[model samples]
Target: MLHAFRLAAVICAVLPCAALAHPHVFVDVSLTLRYDAQGRLAGIDEVWAYDELYSLLMLTEAGVEGTVDPGQMAALRGLDANWDPLNGGRLTVEPPDGPAVLAQPRHLSTQWQGNRMVTRRRHALSPPVAGDGPVFVRVYDPTYYVDFAMPSQVVIQGRAGCQASLQSGQTRGQDDAYAATLRAALAQELDRAGPDDVQVDIGAVGADSIAVSCGR
Candidate 1:
């Protein structure tokens, strides 16, 4: 998925302004917040389901065709080789009191779910975050070039007293508004840009996230 959109980005540079106004890849995410027996934050298990277009692109890139089998699914597992470190592998954990670091994703796996491609992986929180305060997990691209919907399903494990809540950041209405704003901005930037250079800095202003709180 990452590689697919990075190529789109390059194409956007020379295409019409409309092409640069929205994300090229869409993903729906699910998360499992894990805690150790000691009740400290251990890691997160995540599943990402890509939109059909991107899924097809991914499969084609992997040299796969229709009706993917188990062996083909297994072969597609480690495709995150193009994951960008700058985006924290498209995820991050925000502890209530400290700075969040880029997590390393492990145990990569993938499968075909109908027309979508679902990928799973783990992000272990080293040193194990210890606190009763809420910890936030965010799935987003700072530049908004890849739109990742926050976890639609959240599960808690190993912590009986912990509760997880989903907080949506960008609703469809809000995204429509944002896209309008971005289109105008991109148009203005393009007017002032050199013939071959057009750059605009987009931040993750409305990223959706999940929060988990545990009792002592």
Candidate 2:
């Protein structure tokens, strides 16, 4: 059982970029899987998420246990619920090379452990094998059958980094189709950003870049 950690602040820290044109509006997260010298996956630890909100929601919240429609969505911004605003929702990312429609949801839960509130959630990994490329997640809304998507990659300019795609509004609104095109095209612009590199201003059209670091 992996535990989710909450930083000691509410601020969404952003990395600065010089340019801001045609940026991917979303966040990216790094799931660092460590193995022993014998190559037995020891544990999945310390996932650094880069504002890839939609991906996380699909994997963690929607619970990709069975059949998930190609379109689904859950609005969780400052949602009023049982726990804190942040923990009330979830995040999900698909395996590399998988279709844009298949996605696993991740939900966050806060537990009362002694005097403090602890946050924990199952990452619900898909294709647990290491080096298994990335997968596409279907961003959709349950109430409605519409789906949305962010281009697979949006290059950050300052340092030359790659970030995942996330979109708002579960429905295919006026501009959703265009956003989806970017999500799929981003993968071609550059390779995945290394595990620890941070991508900010995901919504910024430009002004982002990654030096290209490995996720682990």
Candidate 3:
């Protein structure tokens, strides 16, 4: 599974001027905010469902066919086990009062859902975040190579009086149609090559976020 991104990089190098902009893969993300007995933020549980095309590619790489069994699935764990520290496992968790920290991903399990692959993982926050303020979360690839579709709702366990809501980072106050158009444009820009000295700011344009808050 880790080879998937490496394969994409190879493809990118081979085709520099192609329309292969960002987002070669799409993922559906579901998040759960976990709390400890003291009602403090403990960690995050995530379930990532890959798109049909990506899933097929993964299975092919693993030499798997048809619906995979438990044993086969077990062999396919740690897809992102070796993740780039810069990307922080492609997940951003910002505590209200302190600086955000990158988390290492621990692979839980994997399963086959139709043609897609559904995998689970957990990120433990050391010292756990304790506050009633909002804790913002985002799932994104800094290089914009993968697009993550954030869930509409977040599940909160081990805590009461807590609420989670989806907040658009860049597309806030924008219509759906316009937001889609903007994201498409950004992809083209990301694919475009320019002077080496020039740096393109990866603005949180299309990055989706989930904000959670407990108590008043």
lDDT of every model, 2 decimals:
0.69, 0.28, 0.68
lDDT of 2 by residue, 1-100 (tens): 0011011011112321121122232323223333334322223322222233444443455454333333322332112121221222222333444422
lDDT of 2 at 179: 37
lDDT of 3 at 124: 86
Off by over 4 Å in 1: 1-19, 87-89, 171-203
> What lDDT does model 2 reach?
0.28
**lDDT for residue 139 in candidate 3, whole number 0-100:** 84
**Sort by lDDT, top down from the best:** 1, 3, 2
Q: RMSD per prediction, one decimal? A: 5.7, 18.5, 7.2
Error of 3 at 121 (Å): 0.5
TM-score of each: 0.72, 0.23, 0.72
Higher-TM-score candidate among 1 and 2? 1
Measured with C-alpha atoms, the lDDT of residue 201 in candidate 2 is 17
Count of clashing residue pairs in every prediction: 0, 64, 0
